[model samples]
Structures are given as structure tokens and as C-alpha cells.
Target: MTNIDIEIPHPIAAALTILVALCAIVTVDHFTDFQASAGGRAPEEIVRDAEGEGLRLRQQQAVLQKREEILRYQLEMLREERRLRGPGISAAIEADIDRSEQMLLDLIRDQQEAEGKIMLTLKQIWDAQGRAISISRKAGKGVISLTWPVEPTLGISAGFNDVHYEELFGMPHKAIDIPVDQGSEVRAAADGVVEDVSDNGYGFNSITIRHNGFATLNGHVESFLVEEGDTVRQGQPIALSGGRPGTRGAGHITTGPHDHFELIVDGERVDPMLYLPPVPN
Candidate 1:
């Protein structure tokens, strides 16, 4: 324009513009191809991925459940403390309790959406701890057998030597051993599995009874009335006085017409005299 001259641009300029446009078009096409390849996943594979995510959620649910339990316990303990506290602590404790209650409300809302298992677990834990007892017995629930398991007295004096009791071990004899005539009735104190029937060792015709978690050992039996895996109930005769039929090394004591009885807890032997009835001297 300065020279007032009309000049045509080189064809190479137009060619270059077209070349740049083509390059851009080709780049866009390749980008679209990459997106298609990246997005191509089977429905089943996606479902599996989702299922894996669900499993992770389940693990999180378990953690949340435990947290909920801890929170609930704290709340209960605080409440109890507040109840026991006098007027001097009432105001401050009330405020703290309100705060805890609010926190628990939020937690409960979160847990509710995660299914009711958290609540159930918390309730079970509280109930178990609150009672300090185990159920699985007909007469309420207790880990220990409150009632005695065997016959009151078969009426033969095995003497004052009751060694089945770990408690009476300090003295020469702790139990009032009752001697049963050979083939006299021997029974299970409670419902349990037959741990073993042995003829030798401490118990001749020994039958180990696991009553819930408590244990009872009857040694020096005449014969085994029940086989292994046989379930026996309270007072169900599982053996007889005297000794086992065969000395197959069943872990029983090989001795006498009298059954040597031992009451055990966990694994340690406890004194049976605490529950046993009075025997005539």
C-alpha cells in the first residue's frame, strides 16, 4: 500500500496454510481414535471393578462398625458416671454428655446407611459385657455350670481322697471321693462333647466332658457307656463304675470301681468340693 503496488503472495504460502489445516484434521482424527480405544471396556469387566469397590466398602463398614461400638461404650460409661456424680459435677458432665450425644447422633446416621449390622454388633457387645455371661444353655445363659453335673453319691467310700479337684490338691485329699460299685452309673454333668475315654493315667475309665466352656473329668470308670462324638445331656449316663473295657490308650486312668471326678475351668482344674454335696464321714 505504501508503494501503491498490487503483488500476489507465493503459492507456497497457500500450500502451507492447506498443509497446516490437513495436519490439524489428522491430529483431531488420531485423538478421537485414542479416546475410542481408551473408552472400550466390557460391561462384565466394569461390573467386576464395581464389585471390588463394594468389597472395599464392606471392609470400611466393618471398621465403621467397630468405631460405632467404641463410641456407644463411651456414651454409656459417661452416662453411668454422670448418674453417679453429685451436684458438683452435674453441670459440666451434662454439657459433655450433650456433646457426646450429638456426636453419637451423627455417627448413628452414618451407620444406619451402612446397614443395621453396626447397631446389632454394638447391642450384642454391650449385652455380653453387661451380663458377663454366655448363653447357649437352656437355663438362661452362663459360661459356667451353676448346677452340679453328676450323681449326688453312689455310696461307696473311695475315701477322703478326692484328687480330681485341683483345689484340694494342697491337702492330702480335697474331695470326698465316692466309691461306686463296679458298673455303677456314671453320667454327664451337662451337654458336651466326649473329649476322650481312657483306661489309665489319672482316670481309668476317664470321660472328659466339655460343658459349654467348663470342663468335667471323670476318671476310674468301669466302662464307657457312649462312643466318641456322642452328645450327652445333664444326668445322661456316659459311663459306668470300675474301668474302661479296653485299655486302648484313650487317655483315661486305668483304675478302680470308683469314678475319679474333676471339675475344670478353661484348662486349669478347680475344686469340685465347692459344688459337691455333703458326704457322710
Candidate 2:
């Protein structure tokens, strides 16, 4: 219950206050520098890390898919055994089926996680490589016209927003699918700079080009003729279409050999038909 008060000289007190303030500022500056060093990776390093992630993602997808196929086969065998062996075998067969089902569920969860990682890696690559280029409509220079990406006009197998694609893929198809041989040459739709060339490992491979303010994507390509940063002209061959099942660059979702062409206007995927010439009858 005793209080003691000590009064120091005003000049000394002011110096102490200033010293404390300086220390606080120094602490904040040090913390900020630490954060920058931790978070600010060089763009080259980011792209390299993203590329490594992409490679691993592809390998993970292949392993998961093979496991899924094996599990599905085991389930089928179990069901057949239960059907042929009757009630006495029901208990054992049912147990096997349950185990297989749980495994499939786990595989699905893992596959989803792998998918997410690949997507994140792709975004990182895009960010590091300046793939998010946008050109305003005015900057794009009025309505832009594009040529068909594939020669010989094999005809569109899946039109943009096709109901079958939506039902099969569980999402609206934002691109046009043109049926062509697996190695058919894919041409650029318009004059642009190659922005990115990537594969999602689960079969989706694509080349993106930045055209003024608009961008075009040629997906399901087996190989690229042009590299990133290449300047291409309209109708120039840029890649080879590949969407054959069990083939390189052809993901599982594709029906067959085809080109998945997408046109992006101001960063939004729109129907490629809006820009391309009409399909031949």
C-alpha cells in the first residue's frame, strides 16, 4: 500500500522515449525484411519449382489411376464371385467389396488432392511466366476474327457448351472439340505471342497465346512446334493434336483423337465458335 514516485530530468526522459521509438521502428523493419526474404522467391525459382511440381503431379496421377483401375477390377471380380457362389460366399465377397469400395474412396480423395496441387502449380507457372496478360476490347482493336485451328476441317465432334460434355464431365464445355488424327497439326487461330505451353499430367496439354487483349488456347495437344515467347501468325502450325485414349497428351476425359480449342476474351473462356469461321457442312 506504499507508492514511490521517481522523477527524472525532462531531457533524459525525452531521450529515453526517442530511443524506445527508434527500437520499435528497427524491430518492425527487421520483421518486414524477414518476411520479404521468406516469401519473395525469384521468378525463375518459382517457375522451376512449379515445373517440378507439374512433373510430380503427372507421376502421382498415373500411379493413382493405375491403382484405381486395379481396385475397380477387384471389385468386379468380387461381385462376380458373389453372384456365382451364392449365399454361402456372400459374407466373404461382401467384405472384399466393402474394402475395395473404401479403397476407391481413398483413391478418389487422393486424386482430388493431386488435382488441386496441379492446378495450383499451373497458376504459379502462369503467374511467374506472365501468362495472365490482358488486353482491353479497345486495346484488342475491335472484333477479332480467327481461323480454324485444324486444317482439312474434320468437323467439330463436341461444340461449345455441348450438353453431352456437361453430363459426362459434370461441367459446361467451354471449348470446341474438333475430331482429328492424334498427330494432326494444330494451327494458331490468330497472330499472337505464345504465352504458355503446359500439360496437366492427367492428359490435358495446351498452348496458350496472347493476342492483343484476347487469348486463345489449343488444348489436348501432343507436342508443340513453337515454344513459349514465340511470335506466331494466324493459321501457323503451333502444335500437334492428341486426344487418343491411352496415348501421350490424351487425358482420360477425352472421347478420342481431337483438338480442344478455347478462346478466352478478357480472361474469361468463351465459345471458340464466336471467333472462328463457320464449320463446313
Question: What is the C-alpha local distance difference test score of each model?
Answer: 0.50, 0.65
Q: How many backbone clashes does candidate 1 have?
A: 19
Which of the numbered candidates is closest to the native, going by highest lDDT?
2
Q: Write model 2 residue lDDT over 1-281, tens digit each, in one string.
A: 89998766697888899999999999989867865875876657667767967865664455344544433443454455456557766564457446644644564457665355334433433342234334222236436788988953668878888986544434456678887756889998888888778865534677888786688777768888999989999989999888654345654445456888777776566887866767777
lDDT value for model 1: 0.50
Whose TM-score is greatest here? 2
lDDT (Cα, 0-100) at 161 in candidate 2: 86
Instruction: Quote the positional error of residue 55 for candidate 2 in Å.
Output: 26
TM-score of 1: 0.37
- lDDT tens digits by residue: candidate 1, 20-48: 99999999897677656758566576676
